[model samples]
Target: MDALLILSGIVVAIIGWLWLVITSLRLPVGKLLLAALLPVLTLFRRDQGYARAPRLLLTAGCLTLLVGLAMLFHLHPHRFEKLVTGQWQPDQNRSQTIDGEIMGQRFRPERVFWRGDDLVLEEGPSERVRRSLKIRFAGAGALLDDASIALLPNDPGAWPEVIMQWHVGALESPGLRRVTGQYSLNLDFAPAANSGATLRLHLTLPSQHQTWITGEARLDQTPAWLEQVRQQQSRSTAVRERTATAPRQSGERPVARWQAISVLAVLDEPSVVGDAAVRVTTVSGRAHEGRFKGVTDEGRIVLAQAHGPNQVDLQFHPVDIRLLETFQSPR
Candidate 1:
């Protein structure tokens, strides 16, 4: 029934278009094009006799087109909703980002987004990106629930955990699979002049074979309420807390705590220095310029040299530093 109405509508609309064009051929070039667009314009022809049949046919075609569309909506009431909200194509949302591994086949994905609702990661050519990873919240997950994109939990302790469903692999390669397991998002929503944030995506998909969907993606977001979140954070007298996974056994590498790097030194503090470009001269008389990452829990100075997106942290003991100088001229 649906197909029939659609086909009929197509046929009638075309017939009306052709009928108008055929009668306007002898007219001027402008009139010919005008008649093609507005078939009803043919009714104004000085010769009422020639315009009679085409005018009636055009009316019938228009009515058929409207009726067909009406019936289609009646049959599929959700049609209108889908047109407004449904994704017709993978990148149909205009904004797209991808990161992480899809069934261990691992490739590049645009990783420039952050959201708690319908967070999609796309990788590979257009088609496979969506086939790679999808993350969605079963409940309202946002610091500012009304924020543009769901702002990651600002409480520092509030984590949105869910049984996430991910399309782990492609159908042909390694056979398509689904991993349904515990998952959570850890976001560091520090105040910045930019629209991106650092986040850690933790997933337990069982077997640990591609346990995590896609590589760790830097999910960036811009919410109008970000400044509000920053303000609220500023008012609260609490330091952001970090959680360790478990007690480290032996050779297992420790999970790095995802923390915001804030300036530890003001011009007033002449003793300690951090969070800016600086030259560090060691007691061994070796000097290097690097940016400061916060000290590790074990009291090691974390100096980092940034190369594009990656930062290489060179650690040092506080006592070994001979002097520290900032690129800024002293005021």
Candidate 2:
């Protein structure tokens, strides 16, 4: 803990001590400075000694010092501690925990620690053996994201991810269960004990609308992998902040969330450039077509233009629309 954080406690103690000396001992204003600077000298001043201070003032001073001392010891977690850690197991007991099937998973985590938008949780030594139902997470943003990509089948995203993998004895390996298909995800987070957090994840593949993972993960610890991830996220945030705030040179536009330009370059046919396209019609009955890229949070319609292998997204305000039609790829 930083001393600067608890510095006020120390200051309060000193101020309270001085106040007691002046009020209780009735020290002259001129001699108050001497007492404050060298409280040890009070022992020789019989009339001004602490023994003469008021009982109430003495008690208040002692309490202040005790409070300050406790703060100095830094008994709480650090400010940066934000990770959530704890045990993760299947809700097999039908305790009304949702798809809480498959009981008796990994041993309860030994510890959970969190720091700075990151968390780590490690199960009791049991996950080491060959038969435990183990689940591990490896992503930044204090939640799952695309970066946790692995070749494993259980995980998702544009690349490979290890989803549900089971290892058993040479001939006892069990077939993977409830682990198939791409999915859409939803998460609910709730605060837990010791500054930890509980993550409830629900996944369903759009095609089948079937649940893949209805599980809970509690995190509150420092993990080696998450440490690297946390540092990277911190550095990225610093860089982005600096870039957005740096002084702009002459003629440089201030940063904007979205922008448009004139004299746009030409592109290949929409079918050749992208897998999806939208034709938007204005109230005036005029239509414009382009590759569809969905709509932005600000209600701006996004279209894309392919320049060989590269692409750019174009935006349009929603007010301009009278109708819109779209075409999407099956793949």
Candidate 3:
């Protein structure tokens, strides 16, 4: 992707230069004369077998000159000044910070570190947010944007939660916003323990809002993932139990009570109410099932009485939505 983008940029630049040469006399005539002389000089070097080195050098010089001129006219003065002065400010659109520890598996057992800074944007009652981070591995050079990310409402009353999707090549160097890089493995908060494994993480959140939680974590016990699963299972089990005991009403079929069920997966999709679904499965063995209702005030699935002695009410937490989606998908 990087090569393709660079190639495309060069092509566009060449085309633009051709257009300018055809239409304008302002092309730096001195630079153009020097560019024109390089190839002629190459032809005189017969001992070098008329090697194309001169042409390559001339082409590079021409391209650099064109790009320099373009930047003079197109680049922002203030931004250029910052670049020259070696000082830059973080974009201040919206603000939030996340700090956390990240651990990964490896022989000789080592840990990776994580830190992030994010911008938040508000649209009337809604909010839009973006984040960037730096991550370091034990033996590897530092990697940025190593996943531990979340967007919560800065407004204490809302306490809204939104998980940002990880995209490769999202982090930017602090000195040059344009210099961006990619992340190799994007991980969420999940705990796992294994032989030949170790974990390390260091994170920084850039906002004034207080972060909800932070501490040492393993891949196996990611609190958010686990808590969400637990809530979904509890909700599903409660619904099943109520349905099992509910007496059948006239012309009504009793809902089946699922057995030894566990949440298998979840997905969050855009919705009028909210975006997410919870997928569940039985511990004994069976295909996964889905629960489509939104979360309740207490963070459980919302359920209504359908008839019989089993009818009950319920709600679920944000995690259930992801579990529901995964379970519903094949495998």
Candidate 4:
């Protein structure tokens, strides 16, 4: 019945369109003007039963033509070209812009790839240098509720790999959604890999569904970029160290917590330094103050007491961490 109703509507729309075109071409100018205004007069005419059929058809035809035009333009053909072709042909040296409509909203990407879990996009040019942006996805397994991406430092010299958090929904159930708390890229942790080096992203769900996706850089290998950043950091650190070593006339110097943590994480272990410590408060209101040991295999942080003889190791996931603060500059 539904199919039949749809077919009937299509036929009526086609007929109405044809009638409009035929009348516009064949009818005299005076008659064409009268036909266009006849529908408006029908609303006021009380005894007009004979003109009702033509009036209704003309109005319906106009509305259908407007709707058809909207649909044709709204669903842009160029945007879905990559989807239909199943390949991303982007420039090797520079980033490419990929555009599409997802969930009725237009999504444009600085770089593009059809990963296993979702359609991956580099949101901006800054991702090439900073590597600090969430990958947007809207395909396969589930719809994304929210997502955040960050680079986690593994080795001081090596490029930090990508880590992400996604609030995703089940494909089978519309409203049933869960957050993949924190899933880091399960890629080869090599700093010397090329910009186009391939990496894999595996995000597992409570339903035992593991979404694996592939990624590649548009320009500048991870190792090279990090090496350049590290060189600049070293120069900056030297200046800061010189400033610190200089005698102060009156007041004490203040430390920037985040900068200290990042610098220490790159140069040495935060636990090894006497003054370096990070205090992280969890989502459940529990606070843990300790030296930053490192990120675990499961993407959790290893926090150890800075001064205790018998070290207590506390494992906290990225999702659980509410705030992170560093005590002082690295020794």
State which candidate has the highest lDDT.
Answer: 1
lDDT of 2 at 86: 26
Supply candidate 1's per-residue lDDT for 249: 71
Q: In model 4, state the lDDT of residue 102.
A: 25
Which of the predicted structures, 3 or 4, would earn the higher TM-score when compared with the native? 4
TM-score of each: 0.30, 0.29, 0.22, 0.29
Tens-place lDDT per residue, model 4, 1-331, is 3233334555665565445445455556665554454534433544533244554674565555555444433443332333346545754554443333223233344554434334344433443211112343322111111111222223111122223322112122221223323433322212224443232233222223233333333323333333454455467558757765777566655534343234324234434444457776656443445676776666666665522223334556567677666665534
Between candidates 2 and 3, name the one with more favorable lDDT. Answer: 2
User: Model 2, which residues run further than 4 Å from truth?
Assistant: 1-98, 102-198, 204-212, 250-292, 295-331
Candidate 1 residue lDDT tens string, 264-329: 342234245547676565564445457766566656565666434433345555675766666653
Worst 10 residues of 4 by lDDT: 139-148
lDDT ranking, best first: 1, 2, 4, 3
Which 10-residue span in candidate 1 carries the lowest summed lDDT? 146-155
Model 2 lDDT-worst window of ten:
258-267
lDDT of 3 by residue, 1-331 (tens): 3233334555654554444333323335654443344433433444443324434443555555556534632433333334456655643532222233212101111122232221111111113112222332222211111122222223111111222221112232212121111211222333234521112222222332211123233332233333454456567677767766878889775453323323321223224323223333322211123334544344444422222322222233345333333212222
**lDDT values of the candidates?**
0.48, 0.42, 0.32, 0.41
| Model 4, position 222: C-alpha lDDT score | 36
* Alpha-carbon runs more than 4 Å astray in model 3: 1-130, 133-159, 162-191, 195-331
| Model 1 pairs in collision | 98-109, 98-110, 100-214, 100-215, 101-214, 101-215, 113-220, 123-129
Give the per-residue lDDT of model 2 (tens digit) for 1-331: 3344345545654665566556544556655665566654554566554544433343455455556444533332211121123223433443123242122232233333444333323322343422222233332222332112112223322321213333322334443443233443444344456654455544443333222345566655434444464456567657757866788799866553212211111122233323455655545443445677654456566565443443334455566566655544322
